[model samples]
Target: MKLYQVRKGQFVFYKNELHKVYSVKPMFRQSVHLYRLKDMEQILTRAADIELYRPKHNDTFIFYGQRYTIDQYKKPEPGDYILITKPAPDLFDHYSLNEIEKVEEVHENSVTTTKDNGVKHHEYVMLVPGKSEASQEIAYYDKELVPEEQRLKDESISYLAEKDVTLQPYVGDIYLDKRNNTKAMVVAVTESEVTFGHGIHVHIAELLDEESFELIYRYSTD
Candidate 1:
């Protein structure tokens, strides 16, 4: 079947496959930035013909005569396609694409080394939400969520931003301890001045990760 947009009109595979104009957003032009619903770059960003159509909650995605659900689409990059229909089980509400279902097809002649280098002709893409549209390029590096600055950004809150010296809790990021493996809820973070305790009010991002610096949510790492 032919692919098209979700709006009430004939969609002719425009907007660079991933990017599209929203019903409430500004008009799209050559210089204007664009954002897709989900980060398509995580999966089909490199495909010569990146075609997609969202299935109903119970439907399936058909590709090259094969049927796949959003869950099955979470193949790692460079070998197969990865799509996201669910969030991380450990992280809070953060949609994820599993990187474990990756399957690659490579040629022996593709590598020119005597020793088997761990190098295969494949892409390794772990997509996180970005904050900019192409024309309205933006980056959300700080803890505060800037709606106007970023076109479409991942819901990450930085405690180190200029907006708030005390970092607020973000939706999808990890609260890592010194080990990077043992994590907890970030609960709060301050640059060099703010003192955190049950005695004072704190940023929302910091509160969630207070106990373990870990957020309860869903994700896939492969």
Candidate 2:
């Protein structure tokens, strides 16, 4: 509430949630404080209700009642999250599922599509997460390459791309490794390799292929 009463790192209830005070600043005649907030409820809600799935190399999964093989798996950058469901060639648009319905691992290849001409072009199938047989069907879109113009027209996608940080793997750049599903800062780099870690527990890996790794989070220079 009041700036003078706020202490750095103190927790306060604001905007219907708890926020930790980050820093205090004096601007002209008034003082301001920065707050960091985390919504555990929101995170848990998403975890309990929706899951995002990424395609792996050479993997095949059913979409819209059709089977699609991963022709090439390119890790999506942070900006790509906004447009995951948009049409893209050879890319399994990110899949989102609510907790109610489920998709099981594929044992055999299959393909299915919408039949009614009047219905919107979306395909769907519902399968038990453990069992192989489908219990219900849901609506989803088959893959297609969305036009660049249409992609740019999406305001959220455009906004994130504008704010995205582009960094070459360097000593400080943060890297997201799809293979391990982890994030680490590049602590050192050589002509053909990279080492990442904070202090005494460094891990070395081959120089990252730009085509396979994505830049999601970045370290700020202040």
Candidate 3:
């Protein structure tokens, strides 16, 4: 793991023991302060000496504020859309959905004296739904559903349209990008632009245009 990948409150392994990052100091050589999970003892380590803890099979972790379990890990190949939460060097600038044409794992010697073997690290890959695939799924659902069920769905959509509840996109809102029909979650909003995860930015006017994007879901604080 690189120094830039270390973030406070993230779980990592130091000296082969699970530890939580307590704090990070930016300096010529970044200083990472970690608390041992077993005994709560604070220890210091360098990025080169530690490894970002990889969850084992069935292990659970929060991704984008949602809890997910690790079912399996597959080697990433070309033209693969991978889901990643950690900072990947070139593939992702942030934790968001992205497509990578190629991926390679770089193995380096461990800086720690206790470990003689090198650490092998690679990007975790997971498949996500694409625009065409999603459209096909919706079409299949419409075809498979009974007439009464389809009628109910159509009526619900009409009812929502009749209500005319114009909802403003706020931070953390998830919407479907009508242009490509992919789901996106809002991360930031400005006067003229709205930014989504993975650095997707859209003009406020364009986002408000129903033809460009459709509001999917939003958490209610009430």
What clash pairs does model 2 have? 65-112, 66-111, 123-140, 124-138
Candidate 2's C-alpha runs over 4 A off are 1-3, 28-30, 39-196, 200-222
In candidate 2, what are the lDDT values of residues 107-215, reduced to their tens digit? 1222211100111112222322211232111111111343455323322322322433242346776766543556767777653235666321121211222322455
Candidate 2 weakest ten by summed lDDT: 112-121
Please give the TM-score that candidate 2 achieves against the real structure. 0.22
Q: Between candidates 1 and 3, which one is better according to TM-score? A: 3
Q: What is the TM-score of each candidate against the true structure?
A: 0.18, 0.22, 0.26
Q: What order do candidates take by TM-score, descending?
A: 3, 2, 1
What C-alpha lDDT, on a 0 to 100 scale, does residue 88 get in candidate 3? 42
**Residues 112-154 of candidate 3: C-alpha lDDT, one tens digit per residue:** 1111111123444343322222122211222344465643443
Write the number of the candidate with greater TM-score, choosing between 1 and 2: 2
Best by TM-score: 3
